[model samples]
Target: MITRFEELDWQSTPIGDLTLRRRTEPAVGQEIYEVKLGDEYLMSSLFTVAEEELADLGLAAVAGDGLSVLVGGLGLGYTAVAVLQDARVTSLTVIDRLGAVIGWHERNLLPVSAELVDDARTTLVEDDFFAVMRSAPVEGRGGYSAILLDVDHSPRHQLDPTHADLYDAAGLRALDRHLAAEGIFALWSDDPPDDDFMIELNAVFDDAVAHVVDFENAVTGGMSSNTVYVARSRGTGSASLDSTPAHADKDA
Candidate 1:
């Protein structure tokens, strides 16, 4: 596929270096601009079903209240912005390994994100998502109401191969400890994994299910899709294998 992104105004900020590219596809019939931090593709001005579905998944778990949430990635700050829109979300913490991505959101992407970077409910932590989640304190009472991760495409096709551990059994067991009672965990992947991942999730979480969302190429109107793994905490918040959708945390 020829990814033609025009070089717009570029800026090097705190989070990472950002380059703006506008894709004008005659076949798709519309011009789309996208932000890229370093080499990673963030999002475009046209489509965002993956990010939206993730937020929707988080909202489905618990009712509106003072809830705490942990977002694994901060690509263009779209998901973070969406999460802060809910009155129920009192504290929204985001962990991203790349400082430039967070900084790009703080500077350029915020306008595209509707100024969610300035929201007080948001906290930006520059660290590895897994490392931070495995160590950060819950600040007493009411642990994380949800853990939403948009780390990679899917367990089978990871954008960052090193993150494969998160899809493994051990990493998920560690993730289970951080969830509060009635908390939900949402993971975004590009493609569905094999049966091994499903088996592992079944062995770990109380509830887990695959939520597939369709996407169309803005240029060609071609169809594409992504999957979200939704898993809810089980048993007195200790993490036990419950029903498939309730506890499992792997893609379809």
Candidate 2:
């Protein structure tokens, strides 16, 4: 039998000390992967539903073919891998603040690493996602059909203070500028939807909806839920204007 636990890799990033771990989940009788910052968990392979949904729901909302995508966080590579599942997506640019995370994918430290890095369409960038969105348009980096953000714990509860601005009207506008004429933005939040965030989304994008993504939790035993906020500006709206969305500080 294999060892129950193993520490895969550890690296110091700008945000904090990052660690990648693999363990045999005895309860489920399966190997599991995880990413951590110091003692805090950033991502776990056991729970990937919302992260995958962030790509699925966001891409589904987009209206056109030949989609070019931009993903703000490269967690365990679930979101990026899910984005590639769509045949319409021609290109995918995934940016993470920590180069260490990107390195894991290239090194195949994570299960989805090979699929994510081997794909011809995927490009991984080591940079602050918030900073990239701010200068995305100005840098002449071209536009994207969809922008998926899963970096922060939530709009209200950012891992770092610098990420707070991206949830506001001004920051979202900057993000919108990087999108093609008809584009959408999807965000993953560990917390339930919020009304105040709906106010912010309505102010920027034409149509937005909050989805309560329900998933089972091995650690918690009971069912847990996440929020996926999808907003699109496609001339008119497909989602009703009355829906509300919100966020917090728990790392999903």
Candidate 3:
């Protein structure tokens, strides 16, 4: 259909460029934003199989009832939007470092993500996720059912400089505090972390599980996929999501 990027309120940044594209299909009836580095298309809010899985895993953690979710990034708002779909989510607080991202949703992206905004369960926070986590210790932001963080590429491969610290011990511990007794912390990575990362996560949480998802972009025809790391408050596997399927290890 030869879409023009200019009409879509293109946002330019040093890391990459974002185009807020209108949903060309009537059935979809939503806007989708795409991130591109130079000419290389990175990702979009459309067809987010892995993001949805994060929500599913989170809902399963707290038995899917009266849930409060904290999402760390607003990339296309896919994860936040999916979490809003579940009626169990009583409140969802989303944090994004970039004000431009939040603006896109409130300005051009709302038609596609309107349901999430109208749900009365969503709160958008434009601030550093790290600062937000640090404040959690005394801010009484505790008791989240799920804390889903889809930041940068992943801890192993960071698309931004600030992302590296997220995988460190301090970051994980901060995440731990905001979670309820049985809450689940779900993290999405562009690639698998080294063995040491897994060991570190296991040490922080009572029980931790990793799911490697094989994603082939139907639109761009890319072969790369990613993994999602899930951990619970207690070491006894309190998160209700099924442990990594036996086959996932081989895939990892």
Candidate 4:
């Protein structure tokens, strides 16, 4: 038996106050973990199918070994852990804007923290994800094979209003420079697929797709879904808006 509710940790971040808590569900009789930012809930352990799927569907689209991955958010560490499941992934760098959130995992406060911190390939970078995205490649590594993002809620609904620009055409094009030619970019969204966002992606990348992942909602006792958008970068030096599909083999 567990306590009905407990607040494990709390911190004030640039965006808002973040709180990590554990609670017992009366109906299910199970303990659930939750992360809250201000008045909004960032994540809940009860529904992580979408988060896991964001990594699965994104990596599935990549076609090579020794793949290097960059995860934009470290929420609950589900996506980062999922990225490590593949033997092909030789390196993974997780970037988060809030150092406090990263500290939670580093302090072993979260369930998946131990595994993530112990993984030899995992690197936790305490920095602004978007700022890094716009900057030059780190240590002149050229670019990453896959960039998995779950920082914001969705393309349309962002926790921070400034993040909305990242979903735009110009912002995406700038982000593409950080990807290896044929590198894949995948994003997790709390909302359903937005056709307008797909159009913006298509305008920037060689190929793009939106995957709808379904899962059972424990609270509502019904089905719920989230969207994952995956897109392949147009190789460096290639025309930005070329209609021809960029072949990964040719680029490699």
Candidate 5:
């Protein structure tokens, strides 16, 4: 008999305890993977629609080929793998604070591990995404065509306090320096569109918009949605969605 739940790996890091587990979802009767930091549920294999859109929509806004991209988070390798799907992307750099997560992809512990590991364009960097951005421009590096971020749950709530500044005006201005003149920045959020964050983006980028991504939630047997904010265009508006998550007012 197969066990319903299994713990794959666990580790102690500077942030907190990290854990990767597999559980058989009774509703689907299939293996589902999950990652958690301490007691906080980070990500699960059940819903990845929005994670994928972060790459699709972000890269879609880029006007040309030979795109240099940067992905801020590498959880489950979904976002990175999604980025590789675009043939126009020439380079991809993924920064994650946790080495354990990178190891998961390198060791083929996750479902999308093979895709990320085999891709030559993918560079998985173990570092603080925020700290790297602070000096990325001053380091004499070429700007990325698109910077896709999915690290935090939302602008209002951060996994760590250090990320809060990145959503502000000065922080955004610093990040703007790392972008090409036409480069775009896309962010994934677990909450609805934040007006204040939009203001911050518009302050630095030419244009910005928040897109609501709706997908089926098998766990809740209902629809769930996530917000993807894309900047560096020529307009501003929130792509509204009529649906909402089944849980609390905070979608995250």
Candidate 6:
């Protein structure tokens, strides 16, 4: 069989150049979708276990129906799609800094795009997530039931150096304002758990914890892990789910 690789689209954004591509994996005989910023790989369809887990673990912490959510990144739409899988979710707003990434989904270039586009509960917004968090309340909803983020590689390892501030105490506080009382804030980190980030998260939110998600790395044929940090807004309600395992780190 011939290995097929194609560049689906590319664009120049305020931060950097973005590219979307699709290729066939020889080992799995599966078509994989990927997004890149300059020379860095942003996301890939081949490894989405952590992305999906971000949504699942985030929503599991929240308790209620008619939930509203804000997804910080729209890579392959895995996280957003996972959020929609829960019947309690009523609205989903996915924000991506790169317009080209959004266009790929709109054009049906991604495997999960059609499902994401057709869902009445889903809305795609093109904007810097950190900027939006610092600026205004999203959609004037006052706050959402959950905020799931998967934009940067990690708090310590950001795709853009400017994003470094977002991992700080002030930045976490700003993000907290966008959440409803006791609302959930979950982030995906490519690196293992960081204790210092957890301390900062705890200072901002009422309770914060991290979960380590392990998956098989297709390329290396080895186990790799990602961190999912979930925190609750300062409020009176109690968390419905138990804390994640002890091995998990908080944020980055």
List per-prediction Cα lDDT, in the order shown: 0.70, 0.85, 0.69, 0.85, 0.84, 0.84
Q: What stretches of model 2 exceed 4 Å from their correct place?
A: 1-3, 234-252
lDDT tens per residue, model 4, 142-178 = 3789999998889998888867777988778767877
Clash pairs, candidate 6, are: 193-249
Instruction: State TM-scores per candidate.
Output: 0.78, 0.90, 0.78, 0.91, 0.90, 0.90
Error (Å) of candidate 6 at residue 225 is: 0.6
Best by TM-score: 4
Error of 1 at 3 (Å): 11
Give model 2's TM-score versus the native structure. 0.90
TM-score of 6: 0.90
State the RMSD for candidate 3.
Answer: 9.1
Ten-residue region with minimum lDDT total, candidate 5: 236-245
- Give lDDT tens digits, candidate 2, residues 1-252: 555889999998767899999999865679999889978888889999999999999999998799999999998999999999999999999988788888888999898999999999999987778876655354456468899999988899888998888898777776777777778989999999989998999898977899999998876778999999999865332222212222221132
TM-score of 5: 0.90
Model 3: which ten-residue window has the lowest total lDDT? 243-252
Better by lDDT, candidate 6 or 1: 6
lDDT of 1 by residue, 1-252 (tens): 465666855777544577877776566656676777678776665667878788878677765588898888887666787788788888988888766567766666444444666678888877777654444334462268888998676777665666777777766766776788768888877775456777777676767788777888655668777787888777343443332232222111
User: Superposing all C-alpha atoms, what RMSD in Å does each candidate have to the true structure?
Assistant: 6.9, 6.6, 9.1, 6.4, 8.9, 7.6
Poorly placed runs, candidate 6 (over 4 Å)? 136-139, 236-252
Candidate 4 residue pairs in clash (backbone atoms < 3 Å): none
RMSD of 4: 6.4
